[model samples]
Each structure stands twice: as C-alpha cells, then as structure tokens.
Target chain A: MSNATKSVPDAEGRFGEFGRRFVPETLMEALDQLHEEYLRSKADPDFQSQLDHLLKTYVGRPSPLYFAERLTEHAGGAKIYFKREDLNHTGAHKINNTIGQALLTLRMGKKRVIAETGAGQHGVASATACARFGLDCVVYMGEEDIRRQKLNVFLMRNMGAEVRSVTSGSRTLRDAINEAMRDWMASVDTTHYILGSAVGPHPFPMIVRDFQSVIGSEARQQCLDETGQLPNEVIACVGGGSNAAGMFYPFVEDYDVSLTGVEAGGRGTQPGDHASPLTYGSKGVLHGSFSYVMQDEDGQTQDVHSISAGLDYPGVGPEHSYWKESGRVQYTVATDDEALEMFQLVAKLEGILPAVESSHAVAHAVKAAQKRSPDEIVVVCLSGRGDKDISEVARLTGIEM
Target chain B: MDSRISAVFASLKEQNQMAFMPFITAGDPDLAATQQVIRTLGASNVDMIEIGFPYSDPIADGPVIQASYTRALESKVSVSQIFKALGELDHEELPPLVAMVSFAIVFRTGVDQFLSSCVESGISGLIIPDLPGDEAAEVFEKVKGAGLDLIQLVAPTSPRERVRKILKSCSGFVYCIAVAGTTGERERVADSLLDQLKWLREETDLPLAVGFGISKPDHVEPLRGLADGVIIGSAIVRRFQELADKTLSSEDLQKELTKLAGDMVTATHTK
Candidate 1:
C-alpha cells in the first residue's frame, strides 16, 4: 500500500516484470482488441450503470460487512469482520466478473462464451450469466473436478452451459484452463473467453480485478461507516487470487492496512502435496500469463493438491507475483487439516459454512487475530459459500450426506 | 542468426525449391525414438527438422501434438537430457535443425544456458509459438545476440501494425501461420493464403515459411512459389504415435515416414 509497489501493469500488461502475455500468436490480435473494448466499457457510463444495476438488484450487492462476534470472541484477541461475498447471488464473488465480461462480450458482438472452472463457483456464475443473457456457453471442467464438484456441474448444465470434461495432466483446474484456451484459439472469431480469475493473458487480469474490486471498495467504506476506521489487517484466500486482488487493490493506498493472503498448503510442503505457488513456486508461465508456477526444473507444470478444489491451481495471478516481489503483501499458507477444522468450526460457531477456500483464511485469521490485541481489527474475505462442497466434505469426513 | 540456417535457405533458393521441415515432440515415445525420427527425416531429403521440446501445457498445438507432449512428459523427459541426446547425434548426417519450444522453458532455463544448449544440440534456429511477438524484442535481442535465429510467427488474424512490429524482431525466416488457428492437420489451406503471402513478401526481407496445417505432400505443391519453407507437424507426428502404439513396426514406420518425407521433399524441390 501507499506506493510500496509498482503501479498497475503497463500498456502491454507487464506487472513490473510479471504478467505479460505469453500466448500463441493466433490470440494476440484478439487480446489487443479485447483490451481496447474493455477500456471503453470501463469508461462508458451507460455500461457502468447497467453493470451496477445488475450487481445491486440481481446479485444483491453491498454484501454485508458483518462483525463475526463469535469468531472474534473465540480468537480471543483482535476483533474480526467478515466481507460476506458468500451472500452474493450465485453464492460467490465470481459473478461480479462474469457479469462484467458478459457485458463486454455483448458489446463486442460475441454470442458465445468459453470458461474454465475449479471449485465450480466460476462455472456456476458463468452459466448464470449466459442463461440470463441468452448466450451460448461452454465450460471446461477437469474430470477429477467433475467427480468432486457434481453439484456445480449439474447447475451449469441445467443452466444450459455445456460442461466439457478435460482428462489431461492432473485432470484439475490447470488442465481445464489449457482446454479452454484451446477452444478459444479455435473459436476466437465469435467467442469471448471468460477467464474465471485474475490470471491468463493481457487485459483479463486487469478486467477481472476491476470488476471484483467492488468487494474491497464496499468493504472499506462500510467498515469506516460502521467502525470509524480501516481494519488493521485485510486477509483473504488466494487461488488465482481474484478475490484477494480485488480486496487488496482498493486498500493498496491505505498504508495502515496490512494485507495478507492465505494459500492452500494442502497436506504438506512437498512439491505435489500443496498448491501454494507463491510460497513454494518459482516464476514461470502458465495459462498464458507469466506468474509464479509450480513447475519442475525443466519448467513442466507439476501436479498440485488441496482440499478446496478452487485453491488447487498450480499458478497464482500475476498481480500476486508482483505484490510478492514488491513486498506489498505477506502470503501465508493453510494446510488441509487446519482448513477442514475451520470449515467445521466456522459453521458451528458463526452459522456460516465457508467454502473450503475461504476456510483457509478463516484458519489463518485465527492465528493472525490471536497475535493482535483486542483493540486491533482484522477482516477476512469469505470468498464463497460451501453449498457445493457439502457432499465432498461429507465424504472426506466419512459421513453419508 | 546461425550461418548454417542461412546456408540451408540460400541453397534451397538456388535450387528454385522450397525447404521442407518435419516436426515431432522430442521426447515422445522416448528420446531414442525422437533421435531415430530426426535421422529418418534427415536421410529423406528433408531440408530441416523441427523438434518440439515438450511442454506441460501446449495450447498452441492441436490434440495430436498435445497428446505427443503428454506421452513425452509421462516418460519424465528433461530438457537437459534432450539436449544431451541430440548433442550425441551426428549433425553431419542430419539436416539443419530448428526447435518449436514454449517461451516458458526458455525463461525458466536462462537465456545463456538455453542458447548454449541449443548450440550444443546442433539446433540452428528456434520457433517459439507462445512467445508474444509484440513483447518479444528483449528476448529476441538476446537470442539474436547469441547468434541463434529466433523466428517470429505472423498469423492470419494479425493486425497490420502488429505484423510490422513482429517482422522487425524476426531473423532467418518468418513462420507464417497458414491458418488462423493452432497447429494441426486440416483438410484445406485458407483461400486467403496467396494474398497473405503477397502482403508478407512485400513487408520484410525474411524468408517466409508457412506452417500450422500444412500437413501432406499435396500441401507442399500449393505453397511452392509462395513460401520459402513448408512445415509438416501433426501429420508427420501422427505416424510416430502409431509407432508408439506398436500397431506399426519400426521397419514399417521407417518405410512409411520415409515415403511421406520423400513425397513432400520431391514436391517442395520441384519448381
């Protein structure tokens, strides 16, 4: 925050030395065109009004910044607040981006959309926007994710989006992104690729972050209105880091707010045992963007693991890489056990079933909150709801749900 | 640019012929098979060979080549091993070599190591499809400084301004993506190929090599006068897949591959 880091990516989309387009020549012109269209759309008051209206009425925006009384008391130190993105329609912050991209898709006169998803929140959100706009949609999902995220898959299909199962390496989010990119390469003329997170080639990271920044912008104002000051700590889970980038962006100038991102540590610190790219990975390219990636010595992407499907990606957003390099944000990790425990604890104590991805932040917030005095305020972004994860969690816990 | 690459193109031009290059993923089926593939194509009158350094995510390639990369990775092939294996080859017997690699690998393996490896491996030129041509000046300059040609790709969808920028960064030859899509075997070349060729011929002095969907021997005849080289990717590699499947014997694979290469070579060489 407060000029601690480089400004936003340059005209060519380089975030310092990270986040340049590393895609095939076939997609470069289309990327330039998309970046131009997005800039115009961002400035158009009519487009802004339409998007704002949808967020406010259709998605129930200004999602509450509620003080989690029980979670705060249990931490026994700092007061904790929850940025309730879990309450947004489609039950995640993903819709904020999908709706925004969908508007751009229409503006560009594209009638078809392609997307890839991990935890299914992005898929469900993409499907919702497509169905609402009467646009053709296809969402690529990894076969492994399909088995675990059946509810979201069904939701997408029922909403008229075709969910293609990718059986490539790892059969997870990374493979899905690869497959979606291939589709984009072939269908770019009439299709707009709705990348689910603040990753991928140029303009996508900027676009997704701009749309999702509503989360932090609102949380900042609401926190001030209710508590009369900015929180000392802003914590969020990072998986492609869409929500975290959005939340961190608005507070980047608020020098007093300490930003922390919780990455999925899965089971352990070994290479394939976790998905914490920022903590354990080096700089490389994945899914069209230069970012921190879980790659071997020869730059082959490695298989990564996490209990939360959304947080199982092998690459982080380019902005996160820049932030890491600039010392603007402190990134930490939450192992599967810690996150699973918080999933249950938050459900019982706070009457909120946090998506396992957000449960990672909940797990870390416990430690961070305990470290601070009662006078300090710490806020966690509850990035999504856990409805899609109930069956997976039941199976993991050996319960028949 | 390497002196050998220029000599190869100049020789082809003197013969009133176009160069023929066949591509295969380096570690597919195994490095031994890849080495054999290079030798086979080399002996078949092919002008140059394009070896793919397998990447985990090869979005620029179609399903056939993508499968080859997957198979190569399953064997746990490393870039060092590939370089070592190729280094052991008799460059005297082979044609000029180029590698179609992802920029991610080049970035991971620093510029000095990568170019040194290329020199050690007898690779004459480089075709990195995923390196954004518009943002490639820095690496392009580094590669040019190392005396290795980093070929730039110009696609059918490229805006003219972007095309001009990309052309300035090219060396040795320009890889003209014959189609507006990824590398694959297609039924026909686009109807606008002649116009694109004419436009590119007027814009830069770099030799034009048409790739991406130039699959068969027949594809060569059509691009004869228009392009300086013709690259056959998935079609040639598809036979290697059959070799790996064991449905085709080594002897038969050689005969089939040799015949395919012979046909394209003949067509490319004939005015």
Candidate 2:
C-alpha cells in the first residue's frame, strides 16, 4: 500500500454527497466543537502517543495477521490470511473506537459518556473504557438485543455502566440509536455520545474511520513484512462497515489490491429478509447521514433480519456507499447457512471460533479463494470472537455444547 | 414571499390574536382517522395545522410523539398514503397545512417529487426538524420553485450570528424550540424562553412559533405578546393514545381534540 493520504471526505465531513449533518439544530454546536477538537487532536503528536500507548498496552493492539494454511489448502487456490482482531481485550474491534472516543471525552472535559449498541460488543467496550478512566458510562441497547446478548450486558454492567433498554421502533440498533441521540440532545452540555460505528452525522463517520484506520495500517505493514508484498485482496464483513472501513481505508489508494465488503444476506436477497443495504437498497438518509438504506418508496426504514445481531442494520456507512459507487470496493453477501458453515469450518480446521459477523467475510473469502490462483493472497478481518454466540449457534444446530 | 402561512399570521395579527397551531401525527389511528383529525383541527379556531409525517425513526421526538410514529407505521401508513388522504380534504375548509416530515422521507421520494406532491395535496409548508441551519440552502431553491414554505428551527442554544444566518433562509415562520430537548410535555417553560424570543425577534420580522414542550393551554399565556404562535404536539398525541387504549370511537377522539383546540385558542387571548 502507498503512503497514507487523507481520503475523500472534505473539510465539511462529506464523502461526495453522502456524509452531512442531518441532526437537530440543538446538536449542531456540539458537532462543531467535536469536529474542531478532533482535527486538533489528529495533528497532535502527544495525542497520538498517548492513544498508541493505550491501544498497545490496555486494549492489546497489534493483533496478529495469521496465515490460514488449512483453509487455503481446503480451497485449493489462493493463500488465506486472517487479521485477528477477535483477540482484542473485549474480543472485538469495537474497543478501538471506544478507546479513542473515551480519551476525547476527557479532553472535552465531559464527565459522562453515552453510546448505543446492537449485540453489546460496543456497549462492553465503551463501559470498559469508562471504567478504566473513572468516568460515568451509559449505553442504550434494544430490548431484543439485550435478550440475545445477555452475557455482554452482564460484562457492561460489571464495569460500572448503566444499560438502558430501548423498546421503541423495531426494538434493535436503529431504535437504540434514536434513544441515544435523544439522550445526547438533552445532555450535550455534560456528556459525549460515543457512536459505535463508521456511521452517523458528520465528524462521527470521519472520526470512527480514523480510529479504525489502525486496522488497515497494521494489516498492510504485517502482510508486507510476512509475504514481502501487499495482499492481493482485503476482505471484511460490513454491518455499518466499521471494521471493513478500517481494514480497507489504507488499501483504497493501492490500486493493485482488491477490496471486498461482505454484508449479511440473512435468508435471501429480499429487502426485509436481508441486511445487505449496499446490495439491494436506495440512497436515503438514515441515522443522520445519506447512505444506501433499505427503505420503502416513502422513506420509512424497513425491518432487517440477520442471524448475526451485529449486522442487522438497514444502512451502510456513507464512505462505503461512496466507495461502492466509485467502484473501489466490490460488495457481496453471505447467507445465514453459509456463514454458519464457515463458522464451523474455521473452528474445526483452525481452532478459531469466528463471530457470525466475521463468518460472513470467511464465507466470501472461501468463495474468492476458489476463484483465484495459488500465488494470490486474501486477508479476512476476524472482527470478533464467537463465544457470545455459541449458545445461539448451538440452539440453531440443535446440539448440546 | 406572501404564502398561506404568512397570510394566516397576518390575519391573526389583525384580530389581535396569537396563532394557535395544533400538531397531530398523520395516520396515527389509521388513514381514515387521520383525515378526520385534520378536518377536525381545520373546523376549530386554530390558525394553522402541523401534520407529523410518520417516519420509522424520529430521533427528535420524545416518547409521546415516538409512540404516535409506531402506531402510524403499524397501521401501514406511508408518505404516499398520507398525501392521498390529504388530497381528499376540501382546501376551503382547512387552514394552511404544514407537514412536519423528516429529511429522509423527502429525500427518498426525491425532493422535487415530494414538493410537487405537497403542492398537489394542498400542503402549504414543511418543517424538517433534522435539517439544521444553512444545510437547507441546498434544497431551498427547489422548495421556493414549488411555492412551498420551508420552516426553519431556532434552538435556544443557537448563537446570535447563527440565528441571523438561519433567518436569512427561513420562510413561512420560525420554529423556536421551547427547550433544548426533543418534543414532550414539560411542567414549566424554560425561564430563558422570553430572552430567547426577544433575541429572535431582533433578528427577523418572521412570525415566531414556539414548540417542543409547549403542551398545555396555560403554556401559551406567557408567550401571548412575545411570539406570533404556539405549537402543541405531544399533549394532543397523548390524548389520542389514551382514547385508542380505551377502544374509543374516532368521533370521541375528534371531540376531545376540538375541546383542547378551543381551550388553547382561548389561552391565546391573554390580553
């Protein structure tokens, strides 16, 4: 990959016309303040040093880039590599952004931090950061998600954070985001909202993508060190496309390397049955930015289903939408059964229990490998561990663990 | 610049009365009931009507208004359906109609298409709470070309300079959020409301309409001379929710809305 260059987003936090501030007037000043602080911090060496220290020591950064020999042999084609973000402190890439935002919260002199989560990975990560820094934390989670991700809820509560169950709308990530936005509007004076992904209004999408850029940077360097060349393709699963954006942003300027984003195909390509926004959606504003979203003709968001709770969102990140439009990233989908098959295949062959979300990427990588020559290499971002999903998988397969 | 909204405010000013604007979620009880709600408010003494365009996610709304969106969605109401229902109403009977929709609803249907639909359905103005200041400049031209007023919001936290910039592009009337929070009922209006209104009055001559927590008739007394209008939303939606819970008839809901509308208009006569 070429040396770092700041990508498409302009000064106004726009990737073409996709990213803009569509929030209430009350939150405008706060967004401006955040944007200013972030720009200043981005250039400060001290801020970078401190953040790098925490990422390495506290969150256990520099996660491995492991070559999957068995998987490569099974596909009988390209060499497969896995960016092991599942080994992070909270078992997911979510800790990367939370650590950065929590530090920013302190810099802004805010005493409290709030966030919204779907599968509770972000909630746990945010709570962990707040607990480490001795700050107050509150996470809004959908009631349905709280039921499915009970273990993550317990982890968050154990870290001295308050978990509020949101019951409105579809009772999922979308509703939790609504509740969190309302909370921020009411308490913008003393609190900072730590958005979970590479989405939301201006500065947030840019900020999150920056924090997560570490993934792409580290993987790019590791792949060069190990193979003496850049990987042929970089792949990651896209919920709101944070991990994928993080893993792909650094490689975007590298024209030779391909970028593929896998979305949850759930049951099929039907709108309501799948969460593949980029595959089958129209351009509409959702969660405060214009992106590809599954909406009706009148602009109401449609309910999305996925075996992986983390990918059950109706919209993709604005930058991802832009990349897809520019033909930089080839987007694809993996169904529930395909992801489950990959999950079992990875666990049995590599002794790694991949999260269902990450399994989507594995499913696609396996297919891509079958189509490529043996000299080519593909890197799949292993976003999170599957311990939290073991029971759900067990129930689906009707097996006693 | 003279539109139905400005004309309504001008007529109210001549009568020495404050404009009473009542808000209701379209398709709350169903498309048929929503039609009745609009017609009921029209027959009342209110000066203008604000129809809440139901979106699946309304982040600017509190529990009462949020519940209304869910109920509206459950009834399978769409933006097209709301416009269809509004097309059936007689334009002569209704006051100037403003649709309080989200930006997504308009962008999804294509802005020009949405504005043209509003014109065909007799919608006089639009209030997108999510479209903050200066950002609306992009679509301001298209809105003007369609002869529809694009209402702008002025928050309590807005700086004086920001308020000036917003008013430069604002039309119909300025929506002054009574509090810094989402729409819901509050026991008392903020003490700084009068100062905020005074500051806004110095910025532009556009008629000011205070909303977002102005839920009761008594809330209008303090703003009688300070603002041109007061918008009551969540309180009215809460009343409809209570009736729906009890399985009451549409006529019962309309009757209650009429009484509340009358009481609010009476409160506008504090002088």
Candidate 3:
C-alpha cells in the first residue's frame, strides 16, 4: 500500500517492505498469539487502566516539559525545551516500553521474560518490571557491554534478573539479540521476549511504538499548553528508534512540525566507523525485519562502533527506514565528540546529565535551533538520565567523576 | 522430479533405506577445511549434505550451531566466497548439496541472485530456517524458479492445518523438527515427534526427514520406520568444535568427520 496513509504495516507486517516476521518456523505461532493478544489488550479498558495506574503511581507519568533557558540562550536562535523522560522510574524512557510488555507477558500467561540489552537501560527496566510482576527474568548482554555498563549490570542483577553474557560476533548488542531469540525459541511456552526497541518483527515495532507514544502525547499537550503552539522541531536520538518513534509518531500529521532523528556517527564515515545505517547502508533482513543494515560486500553484517552502547547497533527500526524513504522524518548523525560535548554541557548548564544516547539528539537540536528563527521552538527528548554512563564518560574524558 | 533431492529420495526408497543428511558450517575453522569436510561427507554413505552459510545472527540456532556460525564468520566466510569455493569442487565427488542460510543473507544478496548462485554452486535444495510461513511462498517461488527445491519445516508445535498448508508448497522432503527447540543435540527423540510425522504422512506422499535435536545413533535408530531421512547437525558440528580446540591436522579433521558420518550412516541404514 501507499506510505501516505500513515496506518502502516498492512497485514503481513510490511512497513513498505521494511518489516516482516522473518523468524523461524517455531516462533511463528507465538508471534501470531502476541499480535492477537496485543490487539485485544489494546481494546481492553482494564489493561489500559492498570497500565495507566502503574505509569502514574509506579513509573511516574506526564514527565515535565521543561524550558532549558540556558541551553536556549546557548543556541542563540530558537527556544529549547526538554521532554523529561529522564525523570521517570529506572532513570530512562526504556521503562515506558518494559512496563507495557511486562503487563503483556502476564496477559499471555508467560512466567519468564527474556531481553537483550546494549547499554543496560532496557535490561534494568525489564528486570525492574519483572521483579514487580513476580516473573522470572533473564537479560542477555554482550560481554563488552557488561564490562562497560557495570552499574546497570549491578542494577539488573540486584533486581533478581539473571545477566547472561554473550561472547559472540562483535560481542555487542546484535549478538545479545541473537542469544535472546535463541533463548525465547527454546523456552517459548514459558517465556516472553521483551524486545527493547521499536525494531524486531511486525508486532514488536507496533507494540513498542504504541507503548512509547505516551511521550509524544504528553509532550504535544505540554508544548501546546506552555508555548501556545506546537514546537517547530522535535528531535530524539535513535538506536532502534523507539524513543524517537514514540516522540515523532504523534506529530506525523502535523506537517508544520519537523521530525528529526539523529544517528550515531561513531568516529568517521569509513565503513564500521558509525552505526548510522539509515544514513549509509543497504536494505537487508536482521533480527526479524527487513531494514537498512550496515553490511559488507558479501552481505555480512558489519560491526557498528559508537561510544554510546545504546546506539551502537548495525540496524535501525524498519519504521525509521520507511520514514527515511518517505521523507517524513529527517535523519541526521552526531559524532561521539558532539554527543559528549552536549552531555557535559547539559549537566553544567541545566544541572541535568543526559545519557550519551539522548545527547545525540540534543547535539542535533543545538544545530537545528541555531538554524531556526527566534520565534521557533525545539523540543528534545531527554530519553534517559546519564548516571549509568558516568563511568564510561570518565574513562573517555580522563575524569574520575 | 529431476531435482537431485528427489532423485536421492527415490533411490533411497528403491533401496529401502533412509537418507542421511549431515550439516557442516561453510568456512568453519576455515574454508579449505570446510570444503575438505564436505568432500569427505560426500564420499561417505550420506545421501545429501546441507552446508550452513555462516550468518552474524542465526536466531533459529541453538548454542552449538550458533557458535559454529560465529567461528565461521570470525574466519571471514562470506556467501560469495562459500559459493565460489563450492563451484571449484568436483560435483561428482559430492552429495547433492543443500544450503541452509538465514533470510538476511538471501535478502541482502538479492533473492534471484542468491538462488541463481546456488544453482551455479551446485546446490540442489534450500532450508532457510527463518523464512516462516507468511513470506515463504514468494521465496519458495524464487527458489523453484531457479530450479531448486525450497525445503519446508514442520515443527512439533505446528497444528494439523498449518502442517497441511506448509506441505502443499514443500519440495524435496518435509523437514520435521523432532523437537520444538532450535537445532541442538538431545538425549532422546520425543515420542510426540512420531505423532507429528504421522500427521504429516497422512497429508502428503512426499518423503519426511527429521532434524533439530537428532544427534546420536540412538536418535536415528528410533526414526528408522517413521522418517525417510534423518538430519544430524549440531552433533557433527560439535565434533568439529572439539577437534578444532586440539589443533588437529586437516587430513585428521576430515578423517574424524568421515568416521562421524559413517556412524550416523550405519545407524540410518540399519533396519
């Protein structure tokens, strides 16, 4: 069908040929069951109300839309605002999706939940939710990530989730995903795979985007109430594009508002240097969807490098690729240095430390605000708090704190 | 059918024997060694051989096969390289070669392009573990258009209606997953697999082969009357992993592979 309609992923989960259930024969029925349950759960008022209660009292909803007055003056053009997802429970936007999926797991009657994590934010969030719901939890993380994200590992383990280290190809996020899928396949009857991002097969991208849309809905109303109009630009950093999709999806029909996605430009434009697949990669299937992937000449997926473990992935969500082709959302890149600079600046100016993953969006917003008129407004999704990233930043910048 | 897969199954039927398919990851340890192993398996009593094209993310694979892919990929094995190496082999010395690849690899290389390369490389059939039902028809058509069989898998969890629909487009033999899990060695074949195979047998006259957790001689013994073929994958690949750790000579490695193939061949041949 046409990409113009906005209602995408028509029966077979094709976001204009970017998304599909490319999993094995065994999980097909599970995916079908999940899709059916998700639909029923969406329409069920009890599910909505319970999730709403958890979001309000447990995770804290309607996160404030704060005016970054100092950063706005620093940009010297447009007024800047931060959608404070960092203030939510678990110190990140990841909890938003995990809570919804945990509820789904219970609905499906699965007693165990498995997930893959790169930066540990999703793992911590999933573990936290599983702990609350009294379900068995397992988080597969790359050995390299476990070394780097020590705090998050401790957090996940403290919450009673088993942290399994993956020592496979690249020893990173993709490998963790592969391990988690394998685990899910072997334990499909008792387990639910809580995929962290807006990637993976059909229903997951839709599922995650719907769960995360709360960020956009809240920001939209909050922006209109605060500024008397919609912001001219909305920006969020994209790894698998969940946060960005959540923040941008509500504004798709608002043609006047520009939706921008910033990717990780790790070191340079050389192959394997960046995780910006949407900017420079070919279409291929990975995980369970056909999307833009960083692959080499022989179709082997290339290793992606980014200082931010969250964005160090070879592929983006299929919906992001579709939007890129549709020209609905403008995709850009922020180098590690740019993101790092923004990370430190936000802390010094606003007394708020942002995750390096979210700082990529802030870095782009800085540029976008500078290019816009003074009357225009920009809202940047502060996707997560940077407490977990402090050690990595210290190691990189040679500062203890 | 003129396909080598069908021909092999027909010959097996004539002899009152079951097909023995052994799986080896291409370029595991290295491409030369992988080719050597294939040549050895081909010369042995194997009716067919399945070559796994190593992928970064083999989601359907268990620990052993997944590790095999990692080792192969670490050695820089690519789809083009695998095909080129296979093309250099003397086809007469090899069993009918079937490729087991992930959809990402096929999609990246282009569907028609991948299938054509398989034809050029002497591949007779394909088993894409991740190309589930909804997208199988289009890919199966492309594989068939390239004059190759797109082998279908019937899992233990598949309902009768799903199995019936899957068998309709299936070519070669229907791959009956002996267990609900990914490919790995198991102590015993579950009794439920017989029921699944029995259900499939009622639906089609095509040959049925059991795989996924079929690893030992005992595993093959039980499937003698139930299945037309038995696939042994992770068990064989696990041997390769064990031998690689010892840094055995290439000839020795081939000998080990041949001996392993012989044992499974003997088991499948008996009764």
Candidate 4:
C-alpha cells in the first residue's frame, strides 16, 4: 500500500482491526464531534499548511541524518547512521507529532489540550506545542515520575502547562494516562487528548504515525542520496513504538531494508523486570487496541521495568502489531545492562550521549554491526539525547561523573 | 445455599441462564454502614462481590469513586482493617469477595505477601487495575498456587489480540470495562460495546462480567442474557453517602442497604 494511504484512517477512523472510538456514552457525542472536526481539518489546505509551518519553523523539521563514523569505525563493520531527532526544538522527536495534534485541537475549536507523560518527554513536547499555539495545556504525570524527572516538570511548567501529579497505581505512565483520560472524559466539551505515543485507541496511532512520518521520509531520501541505495537495515527502540513507527513507515515498502525493533529487556525476564512486550508478551489488548502486551494470565497490566523511562510501557503501537504479524519487521530485546554499556560506549566513541530509550537501538546496532560486512549500512534513529538520563545512568552504572 | 461464584457459573450454563453481580466501595461513608451494605448485598442473591480497596488517589476511578475514597480514607480504613473486616465474614453466608485495588497498594504491601494474606483472609479473587498482563505472570502463579482467582479487566480500548492473551491468562471471570473511562454511574451501556463483549465471550469459556459506569439497574438489564454477570459500584456508594448521618443506627443502615439490594435484584430479574 502507498505510505500515505496506509497511514490514513478509514471512514470510521480505524487502521485494519485497530482504532475505534470506544469512549463512555457521555463522551461519545464529544468524540463524534472531534471525529467530524478532524475530517473537516484534514481536507482544509490552510489548516495543513499552518501545522506544516509550525513543524518546520518552530519544531525544526527535516532533522539531520548524520553518519556515525566514529561509532561505525569502533564497531569495525557496517556503516552506521543516526536520524538526529534530538536536534528538534524540544530536544526529542515528540514535538513533531505534538505540534500537529495541537494545531488540530485549535482548529477543532478546542481551548485546552490534555496529555499523559512518562519520563515527561511527551508532556514537555505537548506543553511546548501548546504554548507555541497559545492553547491552554494540562499535563498528567505519575507522582513518582514527577519526582525523578523534575527537570522535565520544570520545563513543562515554564512553558505554562498545568502539571498534575498522578499518585494512583504504580504512579507511572499508565496511571498518568488514566488520570488524563478521566479529565478528557469530563471536559470533552473543550478539550483534546494529545496522546504522546503511537498508542491509545485507533485514530491516535494513525495520526501520530502520519505526523512522525517526516522522520522516515527524510531519512529515506538522505540514505538514497548518500549510498545510491537503501540501507541494509534500520533499528529503533520500541516503547509505545512512535519513533520506530515513524522511521519504519517510509521503509516498510522497501523489500531490501531489514527493520528491527529493540525492546527494553530491563534486567531480564524475571518477574517485574522488563518492558520487552514483543519479546516476552503475548497478544492482549491495552490502551484501546489489541497488540502484544506485558500482562499476567488474568490480563491485568504488569509493572514494566526499564532503565529508560520512555520505553517503560506494557503495550506498543497497533501498526507495529500489524507489521509484526505480517513478518515485515523483526523484533528483539536489549537488556538494561547491555543498553547501559552501549550508552557509555557511544558516548565515549561518538561523543553522542543518546537518551536511554535510544540506547536500546544503539545496543542492537552495535551487535548487528559486528555481524554485518563493512559494505552494509545500518541506520539507527537516535530519537533523543541522553541529557535527561544522566542522573539515572550515573545511579545505574555507579559512575559519579 | 446461594451459588458460590464457581457454582453460579456451572448452574447458569446448565439452566441456560446468567447471574447478577453488583460492586460497592467498602467504607464509603462509614465503616459500620459500609459493612452492613456488604452484608446486605451478599444476602441479595448477587453472584459475586467486588469490594474496592480505597486508595488515596484512585486514578482509574472517576469523581464519584474519588469522593468515596476520600470518605474511606477519612474514616481511617487501612488495608489491614479491610482484611480484618473481611475475615469476620461467615464464609458460608457471604458471597465470594474479590478485591479491586490499584497496584500501588499491592506493591507497597508486597505482591507475594498480599496474595498469601488474601488467601488466608477469605478473599477469593483480586482485580488489580494497573497491573498489565505480561508483568502479572509471577503474581498469577502465586495466586493460582494459593487457590485464589486473579481477575482481568478487558477495556473497550483493548485490541482483539490482547483480549485473547488476557483471556488465556485470566481466571474466575473476565471483567469487560464497558466504557473507556473509569468507574462511575451511567444511564446506559453502549450497544456497540456489547458486540465487543460478545466477541470476547466467543474467545474464551470464562464467564464475562461487565463493569465501569454500571450504576443503575437498567444498565445491568440488557447484559442479563449476553453476559454472565453485571457489576455496579458508584451508584451503591452514592446511596451510602446519602444515608450517612451521625445518628443513624446500624439497624437503620442495614435496612437501607437491604432495600437498595432488593430493588437492584428485582430490577435484574425483571429486566
């Protein structure tokens, strides 16, 4: 299927068997109204142009596809490339999707934007986007995450977004999502749920992937121009699998490009020790879609452990599920220990301290490069920088500096 | 004897019938009154009881439940107190009691220790709202060993593949979150989601129990034929809140609960 056509939602706003408005009855009217507004805006060229302008001028669109020469030489094999999403204005690839959704929320005549954040990356991005659009923004974060990711909380507040610390459940991403959803349900009249990842219910995944496709679209052309051919393989870490979905979309049709998703393996498969849903999870429903999830036999969501806060989730994007079932892409796990070692290795070798979330991809790339030939090329999406992870990494590795 | 949860399902299949279930947050207004409410519900021929373990911040719960939680916490109801009170229930007299709690409470208590205590305290099942299926394996194994059911919630937002996976791991009954939002009272459950419930029923032999926003009697009426049971929470709690007065005698509270339960049971049978 054509990338654009594959990415767009169907008439009912679903992707394959995924994506439906399964909200409460009180909010059903609001969701229908939202669906109507989204449809109207989708056809409006002016709306699309405004969103595109923000993405390019405000969020720094067309992020670089830099060749990681030093790391490639150190690995002593395949040439490695990095999609510089860290160069985005908000310091992560999340801004691209946030800017698009925030614009849509405004066009729909919504006055407030509500979002759930884990590790605060998505919250910060949403806050930044809302601020730029002059929209009222409220972000829900797990109380524990608020304590750990204080910097992000500060940044979000500085951007003038109201930060609500969710103390229920594990006090993590899932709890934050639950709280944000409750707020949206109550205030659906004037609010938009700016889902962070390529998850939630149906239209969210489809919409997020569409906004982030710029990553893959840009990287694909850059690769072709650099090597006169597609890269041999592409690697990205999968949390809710947004960045990976974005980077993999343009390349899915390329039969020659091998796509690999690196899931956080935490310490190991010991109970309560990892977030590698695809590697360890069975097919289950979560966040409004059916896909692989880390759950117990009774189908209760399990507490997912990961070194990277962003990748600490039990479910992934639905499109990833489709791609996974179709055998179009491969999935693997990278342990916290392995990811940590790679995080340090890349920092020392390439001077790039990637976000712990992106280090999983770096870990896999290091292993894959060792097996591939020098002529082979492996492009890893360096989704975000590691400045946010310095304290956690130090505590994890016992490195004071 | 009124059918135990297991026997209720067995008889339902034999008679080509379904069971009625109603959920209420324990200690919503006051401890004594809430206990009476539970006893009343048990006597009403309800299939099973879902007793919410009130947390300070119940993220998955809406405003009604949040208010109930505030009242419960104000009453100083600790997890220990909940177990102690449940331990007082005559096992033969009370219906099967399942604890619906958030993960924070369980994690703080320690998963293994909590399951062991639950088994000892006469709790037959647990529905931890925040625990994802994959991460629940170890806890599931422990709960299974202790002969307790670890119930799973399947939300409207859940994908089909997820439903199958959750069904495979689930025990007791499968909880279908009829709506996307948290627990609260609603006028009606959407007809479209009923089809999703039907889809889950075909995927597993386990009895399907629908919850979330099931406040009124009419909400459970339609599910009588399609689902194995129905669960209600916020509406019952609201009833207790309305009745709570410093001077109300225990007998008076029990009478109120009995009246509410009788009305609910009558609605279920008639609808």
- Scored against the native two-chain complex, candidate 3 gets a DockQ of 0.74
DockQ of each: 0.78, 0.83, 0.74, 0.09
Q: What is the lDDT of residue A227 in candidate 4?
A: 86
- Flag the better candidate by lDDT, 1 or 4: 1
Clashing pairs in 2: none
Off by over 4 Å in 2: A1-6, B247-249
**Candidate 3 regions with alpha-carbon error over 4 angstroms:** A1-3
Please name the candidate that would achieve the greatest TM-score relative to the true structure.
1
> Per-residue CA lDDT of candidate 1, range A1-401, in tens?
33554368889898888888999988998898999999999889999999999999989998999898998899999999999999999999999999999999999999999999987889999999999899999999989888977888889999999999999766888888888888888788999999989999988999999999999999999999998999999999998999999999998878889999999999999999999999999999988899999999988999899999889889999999888887889999999999999999999999999999999999988899999999899999999999887887888999986
Candidate with more favorable, higher TM-score: 3 or 4: 3
Question: Model 4 — interface RMS deviation?
Answer: 9.0
> What DockQ class does candidate 3 belong to?
medium
**Candidate 4 per-residue lDDT over residues B181-220, each given as its tens digit:** 7778778889867898778877988888888877666676
**Can you write out model 3's per-residue Cα lDDT over A1-401, one digit (the tens) per residue?**
22343688787788877898888888887888899999999999999999999999999998999999999999999999999999999999999999999999999999999999998999999999999999999999999889988988999999999999998677889999988888877788899999999999889999999999999999999999988999999999998999998999898778888899999998998878999999988898889998898988767788888989899999889989888888889999999999999999999999999999999999999999999998999999999999888888899999876
TM-score of chain A of each: 0.98, 0.98, 0.98, 0.95
lDDT of 2 by residue, B40-95 (tens): 88788688899999988899999999998898889888888889999899988889
Residue A40 in model 2: lDDT: 88
DockQ of 1: 0.78
List native contact recovery per candidate, as a fraction of 1. Answer: 0.72, 0.80, 0.72, 0.08
lDDT of 2 by residue, A3-71 (tens): 323466887777876888888898888898899999989999999999999999998989999999999
Better of 1 and 4 by DockQ: 1
TM-score of each: 0.98, 0.98, 0.97, 0.69
